[model samples]
Target chain A: MTGRDRSGGTRAWGLTVAVLAALAAMWPLLPDYNQITLARVMVFAIFAIGYNILFGYTGLLSLGHALFFAAGLYAAGLGARDGGLTAVPAFLAGILAGAGLAAGVGALALRTAGVAFMIVTLMFAQAGYLALLYFNEWTRGDEGFNLPAASRTVLGLELAGADMRYGTALALFALATLIATWLARSPLGRVMVAVRENEARAAMLGYDTGRVKLAAVTISGAFSGAAGAAYGLIDGYAGATFASVQYSILPLLWVLVGGAGTVLGPLVGAVFMFYLIDLTSGLTDAYMLVAGAVLVLVTLFAPRGIMGEVRRRVARWLP
Target chain B: MDFGPHLMLAAIEGAVAAAVLALTALGLSLVFGVMRVVNVAHGEFFMLGAVLAWAVAHLVPGPAWAGYLAALVLAPLLVGLLAAAADWVVLKRVQYDPERTIVATIGLLYILQQATLMAYGPEARPVAAPFDARIALPWPEWGPEGLVLTWPWGLGTTAWKLVVIAAAALLVALVFVLVQRSRAGLVMRATQFDRETAQAFGIPVARVFALTFALGAALAAIGGVLVVPIQQAHYLMGGDPLLLSFIVVIIGGLGSLRGTVVAAILIGMSDGIVSVFFSPTLAKILATLLVAFVLIFRPQGLYGTRAA
Candidate 1:
């Protein structure tokens, strides 16, 4: 790599190091509550990254992302609740459930483009949410469900404490980041970018644009499911709220505000949004108002997002 | 249940729902037709109109009829001005990119919803009808044991529903006349068809767009005001309508007023009839599924022309 590439790669590596360092430093100082918050933020970042694959890479806006997220949460929650599976198997089940759900929805929704795609995805997501609500006996509806506290074991190693959960979350976050980075450099990743740039042209070049979109959505859903399972395990609860329209949009905002094109963007955006939510909740009861204002301001002034802005400024300084 | 009364009620409910949905969807369709941006915040404009109508009625403290009249005339005009200003400030800047505009409008939706919550405190505000009077239609009743017939009447019943329906119809008629016969409407149609060509022909394309946005806002506001009598105005009232309007616009076809009207009516009737047999939540799910199926098969919608 050249100096520029080296610096870019270094910056990416530095982010992981910084996050790990911060986690290590804060481990002893953070209470259970803050640990839970950090875990939630990391999980949401995972979810947002999944979203960025489809929205950022493929240029398809699927409003029903919560469907996949919820599928994972419910799969894990139900599987673990019934005592049929442990943490690892339940987590895998969740990922499978999310992927299946995305594949099914993507089959029909990927047929159209633009607003139609948005509406179809939204329709399926809402349908899934309603189905959960209607089957209240199964999902417990809006009341939500709690997971029994069990010692999480990873390959014969016992992880029972809050610290262990934190470590587990960090490991999952790292794995997700690594996978996302690898995918971005893969041939499939290049095809996704090409599809995003021009679907017609991509199709003209003998690419199955529909299959590419579906594959991206399916993979994205799998990661989102992983995130949801982590969320359920860490929080010890899962609800239909995880599948709501609000949850669906929050990630979109995170991706947009942090910058969608970069792997680091969703991570930074998630952390920024989570902290912003915490800060704004302290300021006013209307956290949504502040969020909305931020969305508007970002879209209007910084369409390239925070990371994009930083890159531009850094480039100007270097030149 | 008597078939006559059941059918009558369903018809009335369907027609009223259709009228309101059509008026709202028309504005949305028109905006999308001319400027390919789907205004996600259109529903908020509708909610604002409803809230304004309630505010005017409550603050003025007049005869119920007078309050209704005031809301009908003033609420839309005021909200239309607000819509025009929003178009000027935010939408005009991002007109070239539909996707960016979608994001921007979604942002605007958040701001408007938050502003509403800040103002109204997240509570549902009920708007009282001007008159307590009800019109009852006597029905033939059939039972297992005996035959009984009675006129049905209640608070927020059929008469008020009809009144709202009439107002919506009037607005639709007005829009039709304006678009079909008026000079401004002709200019708008010309600009929508070919922006560059219209500009080349010395037509004020920018002005047409601004005016179209304002008009769409005004129509949405009217729908909002009409809906307040039946449903309470709240901060989140805009969300359901926004989703429903999307379905209507998609089914009707983008940029076709006639298509929007038909789609809205179809959706409204379907919702009403489905809700009667099934739960409201289920009805919503069904309606959404129906739209999804239709879009998958006929991607351009029932009336939409294929994009070039």
Candidate 2:
């Protein structure tokens, strides 16, 4: 509704650098327990950022991104276990699997728009989840599979410890955030915004809206997939629950609360929700009740999300 | 393997499934058709109905029939009221923005589910059927001289199951009549057709929306009440009904009542046969795949008019 940019590119870059520096500084100071939780936050942050490419910037509200996330995690986890490959190779396989799955699903789902697109993606994700459940031989269904401790080692770093896992998660989160920020500023990102703002107008202007959307979905899927891989590596477990609709909705809650389109929204939302869950879980097992209540309050009161609202109010003060 | 008896059994199972699915899907379809907001918590309402039925039947001091009857009438009404309250407290505050309402309903879903879990516990509980006289199904077999009817002992269904089918059909018909014939229906249709214009013409648009939402929930609740006797009630029972209802709604065409019924019957029947013959998981997979196909090839659905 108002101007978001108030200064030259340097301000935004500086802000990002400052935020990353602050996060990096907290690594050593955070206790072991907090470190593990923070690692999870980082993985989910990666998910939210990738999800933002389609939902936040591109105006696609998918309830099925968990499909790709799980795909990526399983691809990497299983790849490492089955192929006896190292972290980098297994992670690469996960990216390919995630991207490939996204491309395939995107090609079909892109044909529909609005609510139909959401349902279509959900259907695909549901089917994928069911497949995971039924094909117990591969996925172990709901029983879940534990990663062999050795596979946790990525790039010669043994990630069996909290510090190493957290470090890996931090590096991945930084890379994902930087990539997402760069993409958001790219010409392709502008086109994605155009498609989001008005699809018909973008099509009239000779942009293949479908192709643009497909590209966005694929990119988003790849990021989610990478996040999934990292998540498994960080947690040392993989399960069909990774692909559930609940996981799909989790990032949505994060992005919506943090701020949909903003680069920092996912990070903020992920940290806020991660801690919120931790705090509520400490209080009672009925943490979901609290989470659900927060979702309602935020959606009703802060539909633009915390950062989005803050930006709107303090436009001149922000990048 | 002789498949005739199995086919017959599957058809009977499908009929029962279709009866309940029609009610649930119809509710979802009505909410979408009228309010233009997808209540992601629609399944939760169905769960509430079943759960409440269990509560009412258990807590109310009466004969089993009395409790069953009370649940049959009261559970849906209570859930309807709850839905109406939700519409007022939450949806109205948000101005019923489609996307935002979805998130709100998701929140509502968690709240309802968790609340149920806290109150009722996670274990599945079965309600005693009002009357469950087992009736043996007769199949025509060719004798040496002529065709004769042979009774199969294993192929027997409870009279209550038939009652469920009958009751659901009657309710569906009653809903159709009320929507088509009543003055309240007129208001709902008016609001659905053009909310702004309807408001200009002196329609209580908000009330109509609220009422429509309640009615939708009530229908699903009624469906849930009917099925609780057959399927055990649990906090997690809502997920499948929600997904199945969505599949029915999508295939039948969003907001198309007639299409919803047709699609429900098709899906219900297929699900019944497949689940019995193959596996329930396979049935669900097929349904999900069918939704994908419908979305890709016929996004407008079978009966949905193309958006102008």
Candidate 3:
């Protein structure tokens, strides 16, 4: 409880090491099909981690993060498809595009707080989706565009093969987790938490709350974009579905289920949700209903999420 | 200059859109105004109403008019009751926190939409209009010789469309009166103004919130029932209405009834006219951009007063 006793940095680093080691060990053991699923889980885990930067730490619940994710996906995909770019350059373009878009949108969206902020983001994301849908010639509309394998080579590593793609996803997931963990303990991250806890007090304490939030949003957007680019490359396809409102909600769902504000919570949340849907998808057409029920149950009974509850129970043993 | 007939048709279409949007947006605004909780699942209630109308009209073994009339009255009531029960079970449990309620209602949205998909199937089903009549619209045309009045061949609107406009307008008016004049209206206003004081004054604030939520949902359901005759009932139909209603509520100022109606008309009219002139996608894109601008410049909304 004391400042010296708060070993958050050590705990975060330890968890990161354990998780990466486990993932690296599991990568070879997983069958090809399960590898693909694990790759997707890692992709979504990156997304949920990026989202938590805004929602979990800053307490800004944006209902439109899919816009950034989609922007990144399209930028990276199109770079390969049209710009004749290699994988690294294309993915960087995606990150920059998503970050730039989020910066611009965050400036406008952050003007309003709470519900207004949520609605504004939703509207912008919807517009992005509609634009993507309407501009069918370039985006292939809803038909979905394929990512050519020739352009998927990053640093001489072809991402087309399942093993290569899984390895890339795992690497990216590890890097994203490390970055997120580092940021959460940074001084800027402290200011963000202060803003989240009480914006007025933070402002009175000489913190430019707006700037902090903008920075958070921009950083979060960049990470989400990177995840999206990875997702597009991993799947070797890109489409309008990436920009949907439903996709936007998915990260939030994962974060809430895993535990908001915690570094590793999103990973746990993403894995649980991906498996839950994957397992139930074959059994019934109402997996959405199951997901919805789980959401409500989590909101009501387990607001702290799976990891949050676990942390609470094993507080002394874990940290 | 010579776009008169097309303009008239567009205006008629706008009126129809405005009519339905007004009812749907009014409910959304009322819930926000009274409870300060945004109901993301409000559109599902509208979808429910439409689906229920289809079910009732089909299940009732009677004349088409009789069944249609029964559905028109019963569907909204049933949806309202369903929404009220949800509020009791889920919303109340969350204690109506704005953020949590948004997530809760989102869950409700998926639950309702998927339930309907499971029960009603994925097909879009139409309800027969209570009556079959098309009134031709006449417009003045300028010819080489002179100006003349002529009835456009396919510019006629159905009798039911006009009826829907009239009925929706009447319902909106009735809601205004109920909110502005009745004793229940006073209690609602008091509760909206200050909840603790209203509770202290024996206004039964909790019941009022539940009633307001139910009433808002019922209003949306009524809009759905009315529009089903034209658009058909489907599982996935709630998305647009929900989006449009949010646009209307936000631009009108959250919880302001008058603002909501005015914004609905402006948006609906522009949507109709723009769709006719350009493209439906363009209309939606423009409306969404307008919401972004509104949030930046006037976060309090067009008519919403600053919060104390």
Candidate 4:
């Protein structure tokens, strides 16, 4: 490989290492509240990353991603509530259920392109939300469902408190990030990009565009499910709000604000947006307003996102 | 079960719903037809119009009817100017990238919604109907064969909503006439069909785009103002109609004005009928699912060309 290629590889590796080290160092210093908040951010980042696979990679925007997330949350919450399963098993059940639900929904939704995809996905998500509301006996509707205070354990290591939960979240975040990065470099990933660029051309080149999109959406849903599971476990509560339109749209904003189509974009976007929410809420009751303004500013000025801008600047400096 | 009352109520609700939905979808359809950009903030413009009307009607010191009239005339005009500014300031920059435009509009939506929340608070605002008069239809007597037809008292909100609907229909007809017959409409059609060709012909393309967006915003604002009495005005009220308009635009086919009106009626009637039997949430689900089925089977919508 050329020196430039070697340098690029090194830089990517370096960036990942730096971020990991920083997170590890900050873990011990974070307060209990902040730890929980960080966990929430990581979970949302995972969700956003999953969304990126469809929107950023496949060039298809699914407005109903919250459906899968809610599926996971409900699955885990119900499993735990039933008293038939432990936290780990319950979480696993949630993940599987979420993936299954997403796959089923994606099969139909991925049939169309552009606004059709958006509208169909939204319809499915809204349907899911309505179903939950209709079956209020199970989902508890607006009041939300709470878990029976499950302890956290990792490979028989009993760390059954907030710290342990935070660590577990960090570990999951790492795994999700690694998987996303690897996926982006995989052959399937390349095909997704090709499909995103031009579906007709990709089809001419013997690629099954629909299958590729379905796969991307399914995988994305699984990751989002994992995030939802984490949210349930950490918060000890799950509600229809998790499945609402707001959840779906907020993550899209995160992806856009953080610079979608990149490994770090969702993470950066989630952290920035969550903290911005905290800051705005503190300043005034109209936090949504500030959040909305920030979104507008970001979209207007930095369509590539903050990371995209950083990457561009870094590239210029290196050259 | 006697179907007469149900059918009558459904028809009345459907007509009102269709009138408003058509107005809202008209702008969205026009924008998409002309600019090839999906303005996600279209609903926000509607909300802004509602809020503007509320403010003007309540805050202005005048007779109730006069204030209402002023609001009806001024709110949409003000919103149209705001929309035109957005077009020039934000939308114009992203014209080359439609996806970017989508993101930008979403951001605009967020900002507008939040701003409304901050300014108006979360409370729903009531706008007094201009007239309290009720038109009563006589109740039908029950038959011996266990069949019954009953008509409860039917009341219309001010004649204003019907007037607004009529006026809007007339306005849309005028637009159609202007677009299909006039020189400006020819330019708009020409530009929509081929921006390069229109530019080549020296037809100021950008001005047409700005005008179309303004027109769409104005239409949405007009709908918002008219809807105030039927539904209370509020900041977050735009979301439902926005979703409905999106479905309407999609079902009607993008860029087809005729399709928009047809789809709006279809959706409105479907919603009105379904809600009579099903829960509101279930009705929403069914409505959305219907749209999805259409989208999957016919992505170009019921009337439009293939998805672009």
Count of clashing pairs, candidate 1: 0
Clashing pairs in 2: none
Clashes found in each candidate (C-alpha, N, C closer than 3 A): 0, 0, 0, 0
Which sections of candidate 3 miss by over 4 Å? A1-8, A316-319, B134-157
Ten contiguous residues with the weakest lDDT in model 4 chain B: B136-145
Residue-level lDDT of model 4, residues A5-119, one tens digit each, is 6687667666766786788788999998888788888888989989988887788877898999998888888888875566788778777877898899889887776666777
lDDT (Cα, tens digit) per residue for candidate 1, span B7-62: 55666778888899989988998888887778989999989988888888887766
Model 2: docking quality category: medium
Predicted complexes: DockQ each: 0.60, 0.61, 0.62, 0.60
Query: CA lDDT of each candidate?
Result: 0.81, 0.87, 0.88, 0.80
Please give, for residues B56-116, the per-residue lDDT of candidate 3 as tens digits: 9998997777888999999999998998899999999999999999988888898999889
For candidate 4, the per-residue lDDT at B45 reads: 88
Best of the candidates, DockQ: 3
> Residue by residue across B1-308, what tens digits does model 4's lDDT show?
36765666666676777788888888899898988888889998898888888999987786777778888889989998988898998888776367667767777888888888878888898776555435321223322222222433343442444565676677667767877899888889999999999899999998899888998898898888888877889998888888899889988887887888889888977787777766778888777777788788877777887574
Q: DockQ score for model 4, please?
A: 0.60
Q: Write the per-residue lDDT of candidate 2 for residues A1-319, one digit (tens) a residue.
A: 2244535355766787789888899999999998888889999999999998999999999989999999999998898778776778778888888899999999999888777778889999999999999898988998888887777786678887889878898899989988988898788999999998999999999999989999999999999999998888778889999899999889999999999888889999989988888888887767788778878998878988988888898753433
Model 3 agreement with the true structure over A1-319: per-residue lDDT tens digits: 5554467557658878998999999988989988888998999899999999999899999999999999899999999899987788888988998899999999999888888888889999999999998888899977889998887887788887779878999999999998888898888988989998999999999999999999999998998899888888888899999899998889999999998888888999999988999888887787788778778888889988888888888754232
Provide C-alpha RMSD values for all models, in order.
3.3, 3.0, 2.7, 3.4
